[model samples]
Target: MPPTVGERAPDFESLLCTGETFRSTRLDEALDGGCVLVFSAFSFSAIAENWWKRYERAGWADFDVPVLGVTRDGPYAQNAFLRYLESPFRLFSDVDGRVGEAYDLLVEREGMANTTTSWRAVFVLDADRTVTYAWVADDWISPVPREEVEEAVAQL
Candidate 1:
């Protein structure tokens, strides 16, 4: 199971597309701001492209809060998809699937190898880095609705 509401989110360092990095812990001295994190199977997948495009068109990207996504793909895939969409959003690569496993979203499906990817999921972390919301898919087929995710983030 994923971390539940009111729980402390695990601290993680991710390799971003820019060759820089992002860390999630919100310590008093940390510069990394809080954000709503979304974990997807792959950034360049057709379903992910459509899902994010629709979310962007709806103006949800301008929500008065930080929002980002995590994907199993590496920096190369993310960089290509970022250009293809030209969206300002950045996707942090969980190429090793460590973050997904920590969040309890990595599992072995019927035919897929264990720890190979993450299920589609969404998480809202407050400015203090506590989880305000969490949603994990039972499987990786359907898209997670952006409106529902925005609703959860709005609560913070």
Candidate 2:
């Protein structure tokens, strides 16, 4: 299950990509002195791509804190989406789904054999690694609303 409000957010290490830069990043370090929105999505979904594309086009959601995206896709796919969408946030590759498993956000889809992908989810956490807001998808779409995320960070 995702960490509930007021619970300590799970710490994870993964490959993060920002613009053309890639690095091994830790969740706790991203949360230092600010907050991070752990955004999970399927790499190939039109809805996911379009929505994130809009966010990128608008150049919004650039709050004081950082919003990091996570997915089971590797750096190549992650960076491809980043390049295509021009997103303001960096994306971290949870290639083995370790981060997804930590948050219980993995979804096994049919026809994928034994492979699984991350369901859409959002977690806003503070510098101390405490979750301030959490939203897990009920279906293939409907990730957390952007307004809610902005409001969450505005209060921070």
Top-lDDT structure, candidate number: 2
- The superposed Cα distance between candidate 2 and the true structure at residue 114, in angstroms, equals 1.3
Of candidate 2, the 10-residue stretch with the lowest lDDT total is: 54-63
Model 1 lDDT per residue over 1-156, tens place: 688889987767776553233444322223234577778888878878987687688776687665677788887788788778876666778888888888888766566556467788888778777887888887666767667777876777
Q: lDDT of candidate 1? A: 0.72
What's model 1's lDDT at 14? 72
Judged by lDDT against the true structure, how good is candidate 2? 0.76
Worst 10 residues of 1 by lDDT: 23-32
Model 2 lDDT per residue over 36-61, tens place: 55555566569778767765554445
Candidate 2: where is the Cα deviation over 4 Å? Answer: 57-59
- The whole-model lDDT of each prediction reads 0.72, 0.76
Shift of residue 143 alpha carbon in model 1, Å: 3.5
Top candidate when judged by TM-score against the true structure: 2
Off by over 4 Å in 1: 18-33, 109-115
